[model samples]
Target: MTNLLDMRNLVAGYGYGPDIIHDFNLQIKKSEVKCIIGPNGAGKSTVLKAITGVLKPRSGAVEFEGKDIAGKEAYQIMRQGICFLPQERAIFPNMTVAENLKMGTYSLQDKRLAEERIHHAIETFPVLGERLHQLSGTLSGGQQQQLVYARAFAIQPKLMLIDEPSLGLAPALVEQTFQHIANIASSGIAVILVEQNAFRGLEAADYGVVMDLGKLVFEKPANEVLQDQRIRELYLGKAAKQ
Candidate 1:
């Protein structure tokens, strides 16, 4: 697989406070999922912020498809075939599902192509089709989350930066969300996922990375990381095995 993104020696922080992400490095290949896990304030989300242009990196390079995009604006990054969806509510509550989905195609220059992508996204997530005319906020939590992904899918991005996608969902919904996320990655787009459910996140990912205090502590195949006894004890609880 070819490397779609390469974030090397990333050192980022807020204002002049201090560097929260220190010499961090990450790479993702097409059609792969990389999950980042750690305790609260471990700077997992910070890494995504730096990559997505939400926070400028103090040093190092954020190379995507071979070009450096470290200091680019968020919109510029989006136009570069990278989509960042944060953990917070991403949908327009007052807009109908169809309207919100259509809004996703605003970046497309061709109306016909945008329409085609919207239709394709609806096919991928049928719930969006069912709730097309309904206000997005009227849908259930799981349904709203599905819509968020559906909108991203409409753009057909080369890489997606997703943060805490299953943050406040029920157990069953969380499982379903990860399933959809895995499906997206399998469909050929690389994904950088920041998830609170460490075990489930790693289970759904191709690569697993453990971050502590803004630095990577472990990097390995997802299954291998899951199998490590110390890692299992420290981050993923023993119950993760079952």
Candidate 2:
């Protein structure tokens, strides 16, 4: 299958800082979900930043749909059908849920198409419809996450770069957040998920990518990664051996 996004030998860092990602490589096919898991400061989130143009790579290629997008602006990348959800909840806190959804379509040139997508997003997450007039910050954490997903859906992005979907969430909300990711992939959107919770993240992914100290460790089918004894011991901890 043709890859939707491909990164080769990416070396990226922020503002004269030492390189956070070194010679990183990755590829995702259309409609595939790939979860990136590693310890803190392993450059997992930095990979997402490089791909989404939040950090420009010092060398190497970031090819999306056959175009090199290494140094492109974030908005430019978004316009080319990539949506990025950072570690923080990306909603406009003071804005109404409806307004936040509208912001998702900012790059869309066709008004009618944008409205259609917004309607589709609401249908996909009915809770958003119910809270359309509510301030986004007032929603429960899970509800806020749903709004974020709804907004991304509204954009109809080909690829979604998600960093730490389960971060700072209640245990119950963590499960729900991964479910939202599954739903997104089911709709034919490719996703690169950087998650701290390896088990939960791998569970929702087609493939598992392991990283350490700014480099790729390995890539495997999710089930294999789950079952690999070394991965179990090193990343999943003692419970994984049981």
Candidate 3:
């Protein structure tokens, strides 16, 4: 239950733009699944960006394992034991799955070490074992999501920043993705998921956070948030209780 991610009074934004995320704070524990839910423009993705070093924090801190990586570049942060598999397609569509896995470890110094990590990743995803030579673009949306996940795991990251992982998938595929995410947490890597599907996201996460307009609104156990009528009505709307 050691804290893995710590953002205290975090304020971040694009260059010269207004702070889309300010006074943000959250903590994640080792091997835990934490989900963040909020309406659009709530800075959910921005939090991920800042944590993964895609955006710099104008003030405050983004610490992982007590190391501040606020101004580090994206690749530098990856070397710091954090990897971000963004909501967008993170793989090269034209590349084979094997190639994508290789691309993931571009920062590593040893090929054999990278391959060893990739072997472990295949253990968690047997379907990928058979599809090593397959082109990423040819895979289904769910499979593509899995491929991106495998690529992220190829380097053995300590924490994963997943943004809207279920975006643009079929219902069954979304379910599959969420299940995979749960499996990921069991593998002992802490995961922070930014998802728009609040209900499903909370169902897969151990902890839940509700953000509103760039501010922290509610912080509670996933089940508590799931069962709370007022919270569901406020953030999830009419379909929440269903």
Superposed Cα deviation of residue 231, candidate 1 (Å): 0.5
TM-score per model over all chains: 0.95, 0.97, 0.93
Off by over 4 Å in 3: none
lDDT per model, in order? 0.90, 0.92, 0.86
With a 3 Å backbone cut-off (N, CA, C), the pairs that clash in candidate 2 are none
Error of 1 at 4 (Å): 1.1
Best by TM-score: 2
Please list the Cα RMSD from the true structure of every candidate, rounded to 1 decimal place: 1.4, 1.1, 1.6
Per-residue C-alpha lDDT of model 1 across residues 89-183, encoded as one tens digit per residue = 79999999999999889888999999999999999999789889999999998888889889999978999989998888888988888887877
Off by over 4 Å in 2: none
Q: How big is the positional error of residue 123 in model 3, measured in Å on the Cα after superposition?
A: 3.5
Kindly indicate the candidate among 1 and 2 with the higher TM-score.
2
- Lowest summed lDDT over 10 consecutive residues: which window, candidate 1? 233-242
Q: What is the lDDT of candidate 3?
A: 0.86
lDDT per residue for candidate 3 within 121-151, as digits (tens), equals 7877788789989998998777788888788
